[model samples]
Structure formats: C-alpha cells, structure tokens
Target: MTPSVPSSSRRARRRTAAVGVLVAAAVTAAFALTLDDSAHRDDTPDPSAVVTGSAAPPPADDSLLALARRDPSDALAVGRADAPVVMIEYSDFQCPFCRQFAQNTEPELLRSYVDRGVLRIEWRNFPVFGEESEQAALAGWAAGQQGRFWEFHDVAYGEPRERNAGEFSEEKLTGMAREAGITDIGRFQADMASDKARSAVREDQEEGFRLGVTSTPAFLINGRPVLGAQPVATFTEAVETAAKAAKAAGR
Candidate 1:
C-alpha cells in the first residue's frame, strides 16, 4: 500500500495549480501585444498586409467572438445584425493608421461585404492617445445619439491630423458635429459631456484592453485577431473565409 500525502502538501499543490492557471490566462491574452509591437506601427505608410498571413485565421477564444453585440439598432455600427461575419474595429481618431483604415479599407468592405449582408462592422472607441482621444470618442457617441455617428466618423477622419493637438478640442468637436449634420449643437454638446457618453466610451476601451490590444487599428474578425491597418485584400479574405466557414457550420 502507498503512503498518503500530508494535508499541508496537498494545499500547497492546489495553490500552485491555481497560480499557474492565472498566469497561463494572462499570457494567452498578452501574446497579441508581443507580435503587434514588433510587426506594426501606428503611422507606418506602407505597412504589411496581415500579421497572421492571408490564410485562414486560427481558432479563437469563444469569449473574444462574443464581444460582437450585433445590435441592429447600434448607431455606431453598420450592416446586418445577423451577418455571419462581424469585424469589430478598435481604433483611435488620433491614430494615423486608424485614419488610413477608415478612409481606405472600410469603404471597400462596406460596398463589397456589408452591402451584401455577409459582414457586419462594429466600431469600438479605443482611445489610446490621451485626453483628446477620450473626448473624441465621447463626441462620436454623442453623434450616434443623433443618428449621425458614421457622418461624424467621416468628418473626423476626413484628413490626417496631429495627435494631442487642438484638432479634437471641445470647439473643434462642436464644429465637427455641425459638419456631420447634427441639428442641435446644444444637445450635441450636452450629450458629449453626459455621463452616459463617458460610460459608453469606457466600456469599449475596457474591452480592448482586456483583449491585450496595445495599439490603434486593431481588429477582431469573427473572433480572430487582426492587428494593424492591413490592406483591403486582407480584410476581404478574412471576411470571405469567415463567411464560408459560417455557412459550412450553419451559423
């Protein structure tokens, strides 16, 4: 017969196991940042197409995929609520690469996949710059309150602007609101300063941080992480492949 282990020894082993599990979880979440920092920059002009390759995305954590709300009434989102493929974008208005994606790639995805009801694009306000970035996020949400979020997005990203400058000041944001066709400037200012807007922006920022996203223009295509402002082909391939997989699995 074998000798029994001491109770104290068993307790220590259990504690070790618990710590190991937590460490593993943190590592898994942080792996993306390791790849992201080495491979991409926020303002790189001719950046690489995809960090993971043009091939099919690897299997992702289910919790990551569930981040997609797909609310049909989500003012900041565009495309079908039940689209098979959802591309969730975590971006900052002050980030040049984010602007590049917004101006160059997003429209193509809208025309090709979103219009066809094969993809949905969800915008997450992930402000990484500073106070100006946070205020801009709040401003975007305020525009959404008036059903002009995309219009505001277009105006904000219409041109490349310096980060942390006066580009996103309260007055500048108000001017952008008017440009985006917000009828009530008074209400827009009120909404932008409201607690609800701050909460909304905070919620989005927390989600990005939880995923270990350390930069602007990060994306999740059907739970698969796609870092940086990749080319339109990269987005196209991701969308199509995810669509096919969803169809095969009867999603």
Candidate 2:
C-alpha cells in the first residue's frame, strides 16, 4: 500500500531546502569578501607577517622585476647598476616593520652584498601611514637631492616612535635633513615642497599598488616577492638564489 504525500507538505519541504541553500550561499559570499578585504587592506598590520622560509617557492613575475629604474645618478639606489640581483624595496618610513628592517637587516645586506657589488638595492616610497609618512618620504627625497638620502633614512629609522605622532613635522624633517648634513636647508625645504617630490612619491605608491603590495617592507628580489620585514638571512638567501638564477639565465 502506497500513501501519497500532500502537495502542500512537498512544497513546504522544497521551500525550506531552497532557503537553506540561499543561507549557505550568503555565508560563503560573506566569507570570501572578508578574505579579500583582509588581503588588500593597506592600513591593517599583519601580525603573522614574517620571512617565508625556503619551503615556500618564490613568486614569478618578470614585469615586477623590471620595475627597477637603475639610474646611475639615482640617489635612492645603491650597488652596481648591472648587479646580478636587484632588490626593490617598497617601504613606508612610519611603518614599524619597515623600521625594523631598516635598523636590523639592511645594514647586513649592504655590508655583505651591496658593498661587494653582488646586489643592488633600490628604495621606493610607498607611504600608507598617512600625512606624516608622505611628508617623511618627501623629506627623504629632498635629502637625496644632496646625496644624503641614506643618511636621512638612517636617522629616521634610527629609533622607534609612535606612528603619525607628529614625529615627521616639517620642522622635524628639516632637522633630519640638517642631521644628514644637507648643507643647504633652504634647498632641502624647497625640494621637499616641490611638485617634483610629490610626483615622485605618488609614482612609487602607484607602482606598489599595481603590484598588489598592500603592506610595508615588501620586497622584490629579482622579481620574487618577499613580504614583511624578513630576517637578514632570508634576504641574503633570496639575493643569492636570484643571483644564481640570473647567472644561469645569462641576464
């Protein structure tokens, strides 16, 4: 004996199933949006950011490697123009991780690789911390006008300060320029306020955005992306690996 189910009961079950499916879809969509936002948010500091060890393969992007300007007279670059390895750094002066890298890892790279002409390091201003960050970057460029960019960089990242706490005021930047031995404070100020400085900073920021760099202290070692303030060894390894690869490619 077969008993037929009521049409109303069948319709009710179908409606409930449809609602469940819609809820599941909504939940999935929301989760995906969250992941997207977290990955691209510029202001959020990622705590888990660290040097990706040898286990993680380096990302490949020949275009990203081509971002190096390699100008011989470029004040923001150090090392040989045709070095086998070029490390392009996207950094913010006010970023804590950037400061960490500047204070800790960069000097080692300079001593071990840059001074030996095994690597070239290019600095790009990707200020995402706000007005003070932009001002500091401009100040750095201004110092570069007098061949004192690295000096200013050392002074700015010499100590840790509260982010955007007026540490980079116009007067402070002027003081830093003087500390970097700009010799001509007037010219430094003029350069800092010039349209050229702003344009230069904007270009760097745009390049970082284009490359999907939403965090400070991001780097491209021969086009391999290295995020966060990685340890000195991590940088050295990347540079060495890239140099080897470049040699093999006859680049």
Most lDDT-accurate candidate = 1
lDDT of 1 by residue, 1-251 (tens): 89977799899999978975664465346434544443344344543344433333345443455789989899989999999999999988887778878888899999999999999999999998899999999999999999999999999999877778799999999999999999999999999999999999999988787767777788888877777777788788888878888888798
Predictions in order: lDDT: 0.82, 0.79
Per-residue lDDT tens digits of candidate 2, residues 59-165? 44454456778888989999999988899998988887787788778999999999998899999999987899999999999999999999999999887667777
Please report, as a residue range, the 10-residue window in candidate 2 with the lowest summed lDDT. 27-36
Could you say which candidate leads in TM-score? 1
RMSD to the hidden true structure, all candidates: 5.5, 13.3
Clashes of each: 0, 0
